[model samples]
Target chain A: MINWSAFVVVVVVALVAAGVLVTLFSTALRVGDGDAPWRRPVSVGLYVVCGLVVAFGLYLIIPALHAG
Target chain B: MLVVALVIALALFFDFTNGFHDTANAMATPIATGALKPRVAVAIAAVLNLVGAFLSTEVAQTISGGLIREGPGGVQVTPVLILAGLIGAIVWNLVTWLLGLPSSSSHALFGGLIGAVIVGAGIGAIDGGVLVSKILIPAVLAPFTAGLISFIATKIAYSITKKRERDNFKRGQVFTSALVSLAHGTNDAQKTMGVITLALIAGGLQKAGTGPELWVIVVCAVAIAVGTYTGGWRIIKTIGRGITDIEPAQGFAAEVATTATILASTHLGFALSTTQVASGSVIGTGVGRKGASVRWKTAGRIALGWLITIPASAAVGALAAFLAGLGLWGIILDVVLAAAAILVIFLRSRRNRVDHRDFHLPQPGAFVRPKKRKKAVAGG
Candidate 1:
């Protein structure tokens, strides 16, 4: 039997994860290149968040980490 | 024993094809957008694949997964049946490669096995419900799910970034593409390991229901890594440029979407086709970007390729199983024909060679540039 719930989880997680990662990264680049004083810290914060998301992705891929 | 040896060898060969055929899924966009040089992109993908193969084997355990009846009460699965199945898969892979299509290697393998099992055993040997739920439904869903994600991601990416900053997404592609390669290794190399383990069990060299041996894992990993390094330039050309022109932002979006879908599916043990998911992402990006045109003809052809891959490979598998059933000479004949067919396909490919250089240059008849491509197509 098809695990409809699992399928739904995959779809929802993929959408949210992809949306957040790209949004943060793109927003970082958009503002980071600006001359405004506050832009530097804001972009840096966004990049760090993007890095964390990627790390979480690695967590999912690696079985040992994923299981734990 | 000899038959089992052949099955092992063919399974490895299929594994190799699986690697090269899928290298594009991870590396094509990076190569196309110049984020990484073609050779370097493939090298990174290869190394990641090598590392990923050792990461997990959860998917490998359920590879056959009720598709074939294989216990005490189940139909006997012979080495020759597997060999026929392998031949079917390999031949279809080569044919699709020569035509420069991005079809699913997993489906080809499964279809081959299904056909061979039915012929070698009986129609009752296949669990119809499992096939429908697992393989068929996933094939229908994978592309749409990936495409939807990519579409939404691409729009957000473009809308948030300025024109100049858009190209900066190229840097992110390096990481996302690498993730995909690692995911590919985790998902794909294990399929071959599962097959070899099945052969070992069926041949009685190992116990039934156990996992692959360490030696088997090492060899399968090496085979797939080497195959990824070799790179399927023809198929890469199709995916990277044929379907749509990929900007750095679109590439980043497509790769991110692909990586997310594949990892999630792998975690859930949802055995969908990576190629389908990757292809879908690219097309989704094409549609998402304003004013960007998707080559509907090419997309349609690729869709047709996916539709026929199973039945076409199944027919060949059935034929090979029929021949292989005749005995020793039968298997030998199947081997000879497969070898000859493979050689011919390789030679034919040389007539319109695609290489890393073509990533930058539009070969007259190549699909890289639509304008030049149309003229070339007409002249030819």
Candidate 2:
């Protein structure tokens, strides 16, 4: 018995996550372009978020992470 | 014992081809956008593919235990049948690669196995419900879903930043493409592991319904990594330039869409084709852009290739299985014919050599209008 509901939920979540990640990455790059006072901190925070996302992806790849 | 060893060797060869054949799925957009150099991109992908192979065995378990049944009341799938199936898959992959078509290697393998099993055992060996529910349904749906997601993502990306440095988007493409590569390795490499594990079980070298052995994982990972590093430059050119001209932003969006779709499918233990997902995302981004065009003729050709891959590979598998069922002489003849076919394809490919240098070459039949001449006949 295939769980079609779970498949749909996962697909939606993946799509939203992709959209959000791209948006965030692009925004971080845009804000880091100039010497504004808020640029440094905002850029740093955004980069950290992006890095964390990647780290989370790596975590998922590790079999131990999913072990109950 | 000897046949089991040969089957293991052939499975690794299939994994190797699967690697180079699919390199374009993850790296083509990045290379097209100049986000990463061709050699550097492949090296990175190769390393990540190796790491990703060790991640999970869910897909392998599905292939070993779910697709074909064993024990009482189940049809017997012998090692010879598996060999014929692998040969069928390998031949189709090579032919498709030479033609620069991004067909589904996963489907080819599945079709080969199904064909061989039918001829060698019977249709009763296969679990039809699992084939449809797990493999077939996902194969048809994944591409469209990826395309739609990429279309939306590309549109949103353009709207947010009207004018920005290309370098920024290129940097983002590097990260996104890497994710796609990692996802590809996780998904595609496991398929070979599954086949080999299945073979081992049939040969009584391993227990039935067990996950792939440690050695199986290691060999499959290394074979795929080496193949990736070789880089299927011909298909890379087709995907990177033949479909549509890609900018860094579109590349990022496409790669992101591909990564998400493949990763989600892998999580669910579905052995979907990464090639289809990547192609769909590429087409989706092309449609998303305002003035960009997708080359319809090339796309049509790819679509046609997709439609026939399963049946064509299955036919070859069935023929090979029929021959291999005759015993020792039949097996030797099957090997000879497979080798000869591969050799011919390899020789023919040398006539139109495409490599790293030709990655950016203008595709044949690209829309180039003739230059206008002065209108002397008009008597201005």
Expressed as tens digits, the lDDT of each residue in A1-68 for candidate 1 is: 88788889888888888999899999998988666889989998999999999999998888888576
Candidate 2: which docking quality band? Answer: acceptable
Winning candidate number (DockQ): 1
TM-score of every prediction relative to native: 0.93, 0.91
lDDT of 2 by residue, B1-380 (tens): 76788789889999998999999999999888777888899999999899888776555454534666755677667889888888889899999999999988887887787888889888888888877776677767777888888998888788776454434577788888888888778777888898888888889989987888898999999999999988888889888988998888889889888877777776765545789889989988999988889998888888888877877788888888999999989988888898898899989999999887775543342212122112223322
| Candidate 1's TM-score | 0.93
Q: Score residue B332 of candidate 2 by CA lDDT.
A: 84
Off-target runs (Cα >4 Å) in candidate 2 are A1-3, B57-59, B62-65, B209-211, B268-271, B360-380
Report the C-alpha lDDT of model 1 over B32-105, residue by residue, as the tens digit.
88778899999999999999998977545434678888767997777888899899999999999988899999
Q: For candidate 2, lDDT tens digit of each residue in A1-68? A: 66677678657866887788777777786776566889968977887897788778766756667776
Tell how far residue A39 is off in model 2, in angstroms. 1.8
